[model samples]
Target: MRAVIFRLMGVIVLMLVGAGLVGWWFGPLPAALVACAVALVVIGVDTAAQLRVLAWLKWPRHDNIPTARGVWAEMLYRAARQLRLWETRVAHEEDKLKRFIEALQASPNGVILMDASDQIDWCNDTAAAHFGLDPKRDLRQHAVHLIRNPEFFAYMGAKRFDEPLLMRRNGSYGPLLLSVQIIPYGEGEKLLLSRDVTQVERTEAMRRDFVANVSHEIKTPLTVIAGFVESLRALEFSIEERDHILGLMQEQSDRMRHLVDDLLTLAHLEGDPHQPAEERMDMRQMVERLAADARALSAGRHRIKASADAGGLRGARTELTSAFSNLVSNAVRYTPPGGEVRITWRVLHPDYGDPYAEFSVSDTGIGIAPEHIPRLTERFYRVDRGRSRESGGTGLGLAIVKHALLRHQSELRISSQPGLGSTFSVRFPLARLDLAKPGQAAGAPDAPRADRESISA
Candidate 1:
């Protein structure tokens, strides 16, 4: 301010000096006129500088500011500095907002933002897919109008956001379950969040079924044993009759024991996280042992045969044997009298993939229907509950097989048709298989023809 005042005073002094010189040359009236004219010229120049500042203000660009002198120059320099600072702050804020949006997009759960009027302001990609919404096309659209789930629509209208709502939707594979919740935020705005709980819900349901099945399975045998004990204590019977009653009790006890063992096996399979031991397994010897066990169980009721063209495998011997034995036992149990149960181990060289060893059990039993094939490996699941019980199965055989095979990085494939036959096959990767020498095969003289049922699991 002081500099501006000094500069103005200097200009006035210069004008006065010129006016004095003119006065010295001419008269007092002429000198006064010259002073007025000089003042007008100064005003004109100042006005033009002000207009230049105004023009720059109309379309301000940091790199292209109009040059000026005196007070306007100082003002323009300060204005340009402030503008650059503001631009930097704005760019920083924009970058932060972009990063925040990207984090939401990468999130597994779904997120949505809505306005006070219940219109969708924004939603992440997961949220859009969860609700079948288009992020851009559905902007500002009513939330209820887009998501057609009755429970969800009512949930928004009620504004009772304390508890999350479990919503079921039909997915391409099966039913999908979502846990959705809304939270009140700024003013009347709301944040809708959703999580896919399909696996969680299924696991919970399976737990319930497992508990019920275990209780029932145990109770039936306990009731039988209790009845037999009461009969022996109260009723008078001959030695033969008593022996018979005691034998029945022992059978029930054995059944309960077997069930307990199977339950323990399944628990171990699920709990253990270690990979199957990388020990070489003699496939020839294993196949022979399985065939022997199946024949003993069959007791002349079924024709049992075994074949092996592979030498050995590299996995936990116990786990591999248990998994292979389950399939063979299941085949023997399900086949009727004179029916054939054939087990084989052969190398499979696919046209497009690496060679693997396949161990298959083909049985001419009352094969499973297509509907029940998928659930065959589920614990205690049965297509014919009565028949399954009569066969003296613990019902956890296939479930154990599934976990064991999975631990070995192997897969089980099932192909079966109702009444004709069923084939349960296990394919071990080349990494775990030891190929046999050419023409060196064990067990049955000739391999049984492969069964090609329509359904596979």
Candidate 2:
């Protein structure tokens, strides 16, 4: 600024001398007036240009007094130019930062910005939704008062910025599992991020239930086997006693084998999210075969009845067969002596919808509680763990059935009341059914001669 003032002053001094010389040479006032006017125009133009440069510099402080041109003047001019460049760079950086913050606000995870005093400064739409907050109204509020979780409040009070807190909170929207983290930013500011973990929490619960079920299933059979082994090792026994022990051991072995097979089937089902669905088989024939298996498994303890209309269903034949067999076997195993297991297959026509084939298995067995019905399809979930284990159940049969139905675009609906009975039905979409193949058996299979039952005690 000083440099610019000096240049203006130099022009004025030179103009005065020149004007005096012109007046003396020309011997008139007009010549001096013209010289003065030209000098004023020159000084005005020079001063305007200097002011433009000064505006570009954006100096923190200014000194407008004129000074002589020297090394100090040149140094100050260079410093002003450097200051302008720095200001430009800072403005550019701020623009970039603004864009970054905008992007963060648009992120799916909830984000909240807090000041050093733990007051909320800014938050994104997701954060507002998670906390059931009004973005405009909730500004500058205390974070602790808004969240209302005891654990979260304690975490904030302790200034625990390193460890994140996981808590379940009930907001206006719904119950949500949140993982909250507080990060320290520049100038005593804090950035809080919250991520929904409801699905993760559910998966962990399923894992724990699965592990516990497997342990219990294995332990029961192991206890029986150990008892028989101890009995044999204790003393020499009569033939009948040894035979009885041997029989018990065989029963335990068979139960273990059945459990292992069911486990393997469940693992295979879970391994393939998208199973083949091109194979089509006769629904009537599938029902008959499953009923026959159920009757064989029941050993005359329960009567297995099957009724079906002729229809072809499209799906993985082996998987459907296995799923149907599991349901039928479960009915037969759970029902008491003289109880009935009825298997029905019929096309259901809704009042204003297409026809769908509904395959149902209803049994007169101990029913399940309403609360436990929803979780019955989960892997290793059982209503009566002891009874299920005693009946050689792996607790994965229903899970397999559920997955199989899902793969075929069908749905499984189970209805039950305590002690009355349980009905398990698989409703296939109408598009999945076709006419039965020519020359195939359309009705129930011919009853075979009585033979040894599949289950042995």
Candidate 3:
């Protein structure tokens, strides 16, 4: 500003000197006064132009900024240079904010922001799903009011967020756990986070059940063995009594062995990531062999029959045998005396669909209840625990069947109705089934009326 004043002073001085020199050569007083007035007008115009530049700084834009001469033009250039620097900084900040929002959107966990009044400020898509809330529609709604879970409301009211809240994903449904936490942040604001913990809780429950079941199963046999050993040591017994006890002990030992073997099979199936070996297996011979085993297991108490229409399947031969044998053996064991257990294998294809194969085991026994049918394939799941145990079942047959079928990219489907009997079937994928083979080209043309019974299983 001082430099500007000095420059103005120099201009005034030069104007005076020129005017004085002209006036000295012509009319002295009047000419000098006129030149001094002109200099004052020039100074006023320059000051006004500077004022316009200062006004432009308040809400700066390029189009409205006036053209200027001399020092005023220099001031405008400087102002424009500073504005560009500020624009770059602002652009960088905006870009960073955009990236931050994208990162939150991509996060697997749900995140929500709330204001001091507990009103929703912003939320990601995951938060929307976790809370069953719409991101745009629910903005500014009260967090507690919107979530509406009693526990969630209590959590908000208590202002105690050290521990997270756990609730079911479907509040009306069975336990499918969700974890929610609130973190207090700046100026009474909070950050709410939620995660789906259903699988974790499921695993924990299964672990507890597995441990309890294993302990009980092992302890039953151990107790029987121990009791007999104690009897032999602590008291004298007759030869017949001793033999009876020994036989009972051996039966318990066999039961324990079967349980251990099933458990090991499950462990092996779960641990091995590689696919089962592929080998072509003829369904006819396989069914016959397994049917023979079923009859032996049944001890002629229940009638057993089997028919095969499928040519072959491609999978591990041993795995297929184990799975099929389990199904057949289960049917025989579960059937009452004089009841019939039937097994069938046939190729299935729609008019326009690729060919696949299905194997089913059906038994005319005490049919499973509708409720129990869904859980039949679960390990140790039973329609009647006493009946399952009495039938000499380890309760792992269906589970093994399920796992084996899964390895073949298939599923065990069960259909049952009380007093009507149950059917368990596995539908193999086209990739695992061989629709054509040398033998058994003619499908089950002479199949029984019951064999043709159509049910989902």
Candidate 4:
């Protein structure tokens, strides 16, 4: 500013000097006219420069900045430089905002921003899905109006945000459980966070049901045993009568023991995170043992037969036996007298997929319904409580089978129709199959035979 003032003063001085020299040569009137002309020209030039600067400011561009001869040029240069700096800062901030929004959109939890008037300001995709809202259409809409839930409106109206609110909504697939919390921030605005708790809620319900089931299972046998003991202690009875009472007590005792053993097996399977050791097991011996157990369980009333292909399985022997035995025993117990239970172990060499070994137990028995098949692996899940008890089943057979097979990288597939029959098959991966010739194809005709035995009544 001081430099501009000085330059202006210098111009005035030069004009006056020229005017004085002109007045000395021509008259004072001509000299005054010359001074006025010089001043007007300077004003016109300054005005033009100001107009150019104003035009550039209206639509400023880096390359098209107005050219100026003096202070105007410096001013324009500084203005452009400042604008560039501001543009860079704005771009950087915009990028950060974009990333922050993207992170919120990708988050499993839902996030919503509401203005002071309780109107929707912004919401991520997750939040929109949670509330069945459209991000674009819902902007500036009243939150309570859109949600249309009395509980949520009450929560917001109460002005209390200490605890989260749980709400159930109808989802596309099924019912959805949401845990929502509101946080007040930034001049009366609110941030709402929502999380889907459907799975958590389901697990909690299952836990409660399991506890109830366990208590009931334990109590029923205890009641029977206690009643029998009281009768034995307080009543006078004949020898046969006493024997019958004793036998009843013993049956109840055995039922409780079996239940306890099954509970322990399930607990062990769930607690042990490590996979079963890959020990080579003789499939023939395993099959025969399973057949023997099934026949004994059937008490010679049902036919039990088993056959094995020429290959050994590599897995924990005890776990495999337990899993296979459970399937066989279930078949025997569920089948009526004179029914047939066939157990087969074979290798498969598919045309496209990896070779795998399969162990299948098929039973001609009262089969499971379609609805009950999905929950068959749940612990203590019984299709018929009275029938399961009468058959001496602890109801943990399929659950144990599921866990043990999972540890061996195997899967159990069940196909059953009510009153027709059920087939339970365990498919073992190639890694767990110890074929006689490891490289030999499973379908080769020349594959060496191990031992094959089939026993039926």
Candidate 5:
């Protein structure tokens, strides 16, 4: 302020000196009038410069201020410099805000920013989806009114965030679960974060059910064994009775063993992914072996026929045999006496031009319901629990088949109708089909009567 005052005084004095020099050539009266006019003109010019600077302040687009004299010029230059600093700060803050919003937009989980009163301030697409909100339309709307979940509102309203809130959205598969957490910040502003936990919850539930089923399965046999052991220990019995008890015990033990083996096989199949076998195995031989096992299991109860033309498969020999045998055994077990179970093996060329080795087992017995067909491959799933137990099935046959086929890059396809019988088919990809060996380049041999055998135990 002092510098401005000094500059103004110097300008006034300079104007006075000019006016005095001009008036010295005339009289005293003219000198006084000329000095007054000079002062007015100087004041008018300074006013005009200040007005221009004022206009620039209102709309400061020019890079530099207009040229002027005295304090008005200094004020204009200083004002433009200060405007530049303000612009820089404003730009920095705006860029930071933009990046923050973009980060929220890209986040996998949902995020919502709410003001002090729980009004929707801003939200990303994920958050919008989480709460079924429209980004633009729902701005400034109350969250509770929009989401309408009492539990969610209670969670946020309580202002106690010791644990996250769990909510189930409507119209989702098995109630699509969401875990939400609220964080309060900046004078009652809140950040609401949410994540989908439906899969995790489903897995946990499946694990619990598996443990329970396994425990029950084991307990039944253990109880039976304990009862028999007690009977043998406490009371004297004839040799026949002892032998009968022993036989029952052996059957139970074998049942348990089969269950454990199936469990182990499943564990091994699910453990790791590896390269498939390069060596080809005679699929015809494998089908014959499966047929033999199925006949033994059927024990003349069912009519069985085995036919195969497919050559070989490029996969773990044991896994392939296990899967094929399981399907054949299941057919035999489910089919009643005199029912026919036919097995066929052929190479199928789909419309996509890819060939698949198809092994299918069709049974003429009580068929599976449509609803039960999809879950037949799930562990422990059964069409009829009592019938499954009576048939000596471990209930893991289909699951093992499914997993084994997965390992071989194949798939299991099931078709069935109630009271019309079922067909369990496997389609192994061409990649896993070993065509012919170098020495046997002529191609695979024809399946004769001996290869396609039909016999009952």
Candidate 6:
């Protein structure tokens, strides 16, 4: 405004000077007209220059005050750029997190994520399946509400993040052994991991049962041996009586020894599941030796027979011998006084296009129930505890067979009907079986001898 006023004043001053000069040089009318035209031109030119300056001033400078709309537009652009960068970063991070969560969902173990407020923030498919939860709907719910176990609830309520909680979850699927762990994450967040340990728990239970069964088995044998020892010590007897007592003690001691040996064999087999297969043993000779041992162990109480086609197996000789011996011994032990035990070996073709050495020990003894067949390989599981004791069984024979079969990558199958006797077969994979040397015969010379007198027929 000040500059505009100064320009106007200068224009007026110039007009007065021009009018005076014109009047001095010419007549008054002509001078006046000339002065007015000159002043008007000068004023118009000044006004136009001032208007240009004002237009330049109105255009924004680098550091000049900006219009409200301009400032708002710039702010909005920066905000949008920042938001785009943030959104991109979030999407990238979310994609990575989604892959990690998908992997967790596919894992066999159950997993759950909880927030700082002890609420279930997220859970994988396995965890949802184990808990029988609706994955889409149950998010953000309290974990305690879903898993209603008292122990787990107490553990979560106590804020004890250090120790994991062990509990059982009963769901529509079945009972599941659950191990729950809670960990503190960033800021106020928490992470929870759950694992189903049902199989492990079952194995532990079986171990406990085995220990108890062994204790009971050993106690009974020791009691019998102790009673006989006491009886011998209490009375003065003839040479025949003394010999009889010593023989009985020897039998008890032998039974104990056999039991201990079997237990040790089972332990050894379990320790090394992947033993080297350097030795190729002849199945025919092995069966022969086993039959001889079985016959001798039976003591003329039962007839024994051996039959085999042609097949040798590659495995630890000592382990294979122990396994075959256990099978034959089990058969002989279970067979009645006049029953017959048969050992057979043949090459079998399975549906999986694999050749296997099928070795079977069939006995005319009291058969096993169908329900009990599955658990027969478990340590110390017995169909007839009293009969097993009377027959001097340690109850670990089949257990040893199981471990041995596992080492050989073989399968043990037991089929029996009550009173019809049983057949226990161990099928060895072809990879583990080797043919005997060309010169060697398929059958052993020391095959079991069947005595007609001991035959039930």
Question: How much lDDT does each candidate structure score?
Answer: 0.87, 0.80, 0.83, 0.88, 0.83, 0.77
Per-residue lDDT tens digits for candidate 4, residues 1-457, read 8768877997799789989999999989989998998899888998999999999999888999988967788899899999999999999999999999999899999999999999999999888888999999999999999987888999999989999999988877789999999999999999999999999999999899989988998899899999888988898999999999889989989988988998999888889987756677878778888888887888889878787776778889988888999999899989989999999988888999998989999999999999999999998899998999999998889999999888888999999988888999999999998776445555556553333233232
Cα-based RMSD of candidate 4: 3.5
Q: Give candidate 3 regions above 4 Å deviation.
A: 1-17, 26-28, 31-35, 63-65, 132-134, 137-142, 145-150, 167-176, 436-457
Rank order (by lDDT, best first): 4, 1, 3, 5, 2, 6
Model 6 spans > 4 angstroms off: 1-111, 115-118, 149-165, 171-173, 181-191, 223-241, 349-354, 439-457
Candidate 6 shows a clash count of 0
Off by over 4 Å in 4: 153-160, 225-254, 437-457
Highest-scoring model, TM-score:
1
Q: Worst lDDT window (10 residues) for model 3?
A: 448-457
97-159 in candidate 6: lDDT tens per residue? Answer: 999988987887777777777678888888887777777799889888987778977887788
Question: How far in Å is the alpha carbon of 314 misplaced in model 3?
Answer: 1.1
Itemize residue pairs with steric clashes in candidate 6. Answer: none
Candidate 2's displacement at residue 426, Å, is 0.6
Choose 3 or 6, whichever is better by TM-score.
3
TM-scores, all models, native as reference: 0.88, 0.77, 0.86, 0.87, 0.84, 0.69
The TM-score, computed over Cα atoms with residue i paired to residue i, of candidate 1 is 0.88
Error of 4 at 168 (Å): 2.3
For candidate 3, lDDT tens digit of each residue in 1-457?
A: 7667877897878788778877878887766776887788787989998888988989998677778877888889889888889999999999999999999999989999999999999999988887889999999999888887888888888989999999765633454578999999999999999998988888999989888888988898899899989989999889999899999999999999999999998877777899987988878778788778888888889888887873678898887788988888888877789999988888776798887788999999878888777788788887788888788888888888888778888878888878878898988888887655544453435444554333221
lDDT of 3 at 422: 84
**Relative to the unseen true structure, what is the C-alpha lDDT of residue 306 in candidate 6, on a scale of 0 to 100?**
83
Candidate 3: residue 199 lDDT (0-100): 80
lDDT for residue 21 in candidate 1, whole number 0-100? 87
RMSD of 1: 5.4
Instruction: List, in order, the clash count of every candidate structure.
Output: 0, 0, 0, 0, 0, 0
TM-score of 4: 0.87
Q: For model 4, what is the C-alpha lDDT against the true structure?
A: 0.88
